[model samples]
Target: MNHPSGLSAAAVQVYRLRVTHPTDSVTELGCRAGLPPEVVVAAESELTRLGLLRTSPAGGWVAVGPETATEELVAATEHEILQLQVALGATRAKMQALSAHYMEARSLRSARGDIETVRGLDNIRAVIDDLARTATTTVDTLAPGGGQGEQALSAALPNDLRVLSRGCQLRILFQDSARRHKPTGQYVTRITAAGAQARCLSHLPTRMILYGDDCAVLPIDHERTGLGVIVVRDASVLGFLRWLYDHHWSQATDFFVDEHESPLGLSSVEAEILSQLASGRTNPTISAELGMSERTVARIVAGLMERLGAGSRFEAGVRAVQLGWVS
Candidate 1:
């Protein structure tokens, strides 16, 4: 009843005195309850509020029957508890309905700002593992340069395998340079055996990782050779990254140990060059990216177009996509 001093200390004294005396006045209560007159006045108000004491129009106060008061208190407490349970259930349903909207809102706000910043290789790897455990569709990765160190690959292999085991599509794009690194190749071999698909690209769009099509994590360092990473859940940004992934994926070499893609009667290098050409990279850019010279890149493009019965580069690209070589 909002008593200022808290659950009144005199409730004890009042209850004790009321139990023994049937007709107790405030004056007598003040004396027998060992309470001051002022305390007696406040305690009486509280007792009347609790229905433990009632005002008797004839004079002071009368005790409410202890059995009846206990029953009333028990009934009131049960009523409040039932009401609380219903309120809690309704709140939980409201939260469930808002969850999709919550994710959408995250995408919208994250479009303006990336939400998480992670650094240190170990911490970054921890975040990746956490994401993988809950990811729905696929785990897509781009590893530039060589392998990301033997230690890092070792740490990531278990969760990578787990994702594949759960029937999640696990696709990784590694640089051609990675083939020479024994540990990374071995890791790739193991995961591929577990139903993951890996490809090697002479060029990659970025050094990053994507969980499903909605969330992305990329290195903040220029070279992507360091530990800093930024985590993003922005829809627009993820869409563009996913597009880039498809682009590179089309041009990458399927990394089966003995299988090759030279159906155009071209060498492996020439087939790769033609794939990049179909994807719209400039000549010098291709040369620098694929470690080919200007002369070599020009010669191969000419040779490929001629062999495909195409008079121009544009014609070759169109033919390539139509043939499902660069789709």
Candidate 2:
């Protein structure tokens, strides 16, 4: 586990098996999970360290509630991600594995036209891509978290480009943290340049893809299952999604990235950082909270302090407020 997992697949599988079958031993857990005993042991160690699992007095392991476990998993995963090498042995593997199970159990086409379930990453991608391809007027997406990785973005790029070329309106709203992501930024740049309109909101409703006003696809598991996608053809539910998109869109700012990594004026990122700093957040806290690197947070703080002509962090806060950069 210390060597870094290609994805969190191994850990997630081990955890899933133990959580569902608390009495299972490491060997039993491995057998149930279809992983090696050593892998399950390693994953158990990692999960216990993360506080998601605990060794019961009976010698087996037990999980906390799913909600609590998921939050801990997310934080632990984010920390691990920051420590990973430049290459992305990203979260795709775990996402796919969990989603495959979801599809097997739940994926079904409904005749009533109320709702339907799609299975597998490929099928989800195919449906979403086809929707985007055949969209007559609009394709609106709320991609929260860190945004999709370079590979996912790359695969969807052609479909996205086609959407734009066909004179369809494409609007994507990403979390503000996404603009600071190197690869995510590249994709955003490409899409924006190709006539797609983009915005950055500090928060988002959910990960959803809405084609025009009716058809919609939304993730059901989010932080837990990685791939539980539900296709909602219900007009009322889709209307609410559109309303949610509109609400967030109105509050979002244009994603303005500075090429020089510094702006004569306080850039949106700088302003956001300054706002967090004003709340007396430390460098590490700011980095984790904003999904930015600690070094990046430090440099921004130092630069802002110098630019404010301030001798200390307190003075910088005052300057930022007086300048109306963050209030």
Candidate 3:
């Protein structure tokens, strides 16, 4: 017995008899189709399932046209296919997540030592890029100096946004002088608007970056960052670095605050300059230590002198102390 359109042979025969009769009881249909009553009943159920058989307005049963049944069967199959496609998409996502976990685990296993040295600026940047791409929890950065150039900031923006897009934390700390640099300010604004945290301190010890609790990157020499970097994976060292970061973070000011809004009416850089002058530090010394050009330092000093109504640097320092601007 052959079947057609997914219908059993008995079901097809029963359907044909019902179609010809147009009105028939299960026993009569079975007698005509040469099938038993039970077989006819089962076939009727199959036709009903496929929409080939339905109750008539004034009779026991009727057979629908093959076109309507074919349409109904095709629609149900298409719906099942759509459901399967959705299931496949979800499975693919899970597989990708598992692969990432496996790769990270394998890399960890291959990294035998707690300390790895990455020499040259390009190599260091590459490692940092990889870390940003793989960061799961947090990416912390301490950038010391006046500010970063627009090119460098632009280059980092994509990865910074990517980290935040994945629900990872991205926090950056820049020197107070960076607030006056337009490009740095714009970069900070963009990132902070994208869920990244940013702060500024008057001075910072060095450049360091942390990728979650797993690893930390530090310049080989704070004064010579272009030389290379050292990646520290020692848990104890990472713990200490995190502690230091937290401490500095507590003392830092939010980057969004305006310089004019300071309680003392002095920007952080100006206040730091005043403090160094009070200690009898020369302009060049302050300039070099603060990573500012001598001309910029001189300009800031002139502004401070006028604000304090002092004509000489010595008088400016004394007046700053008297005004409680410095100790």
Task: Specify the highest-lDDT model's number.
Answer: 3
Give one digit per residue, the lDDT tens place, for model 2 in 1-327. 432533267877776777679887677777777888888877877777767788789877788765786797799888888767323545666577787676564324322256767778888887777677668899988887644677788887899999999999999888787876788778878988999988887556568888886578888775432566888877778788888888989988777633223244766567777887887889886775555678988999999898889888888888878887667
**Cα lDDT over the full model 2:** 0.76
In candidate 3, stretches whose alpha carbon ends up further than 4 angstroms from where it belongs are 1-113, 260-265, 288-291, 306-323
Least well predicted 10-residue stretch by lDDT in candidate 3: 105-114
Q: Local error of candidate 3 at 244, Å?
A: 1.5
Off by over 4 Å in 2: 1-113, 257-327
In candidate 3, position 301 carries an lDDT of 93
TM-score of each: 0.47, 0.49, 0.62
Top-TM-score candidate index: 3
Q: Rank the candidates by lDDT, best first.
A: 3, 1, 2
Candidate 3, 92-122: lDDT as tens digits: 9999989978888848853634688899768
lDDT of each: 0.77, 0.76, 0.86
Of 1 and 2, the candidate ahead on lDDT is 1
Model 2 steric clash pairs: none
Which should have the higher TM-score, number 1 or number 2? 2
lDDT of 3 at 214: 84
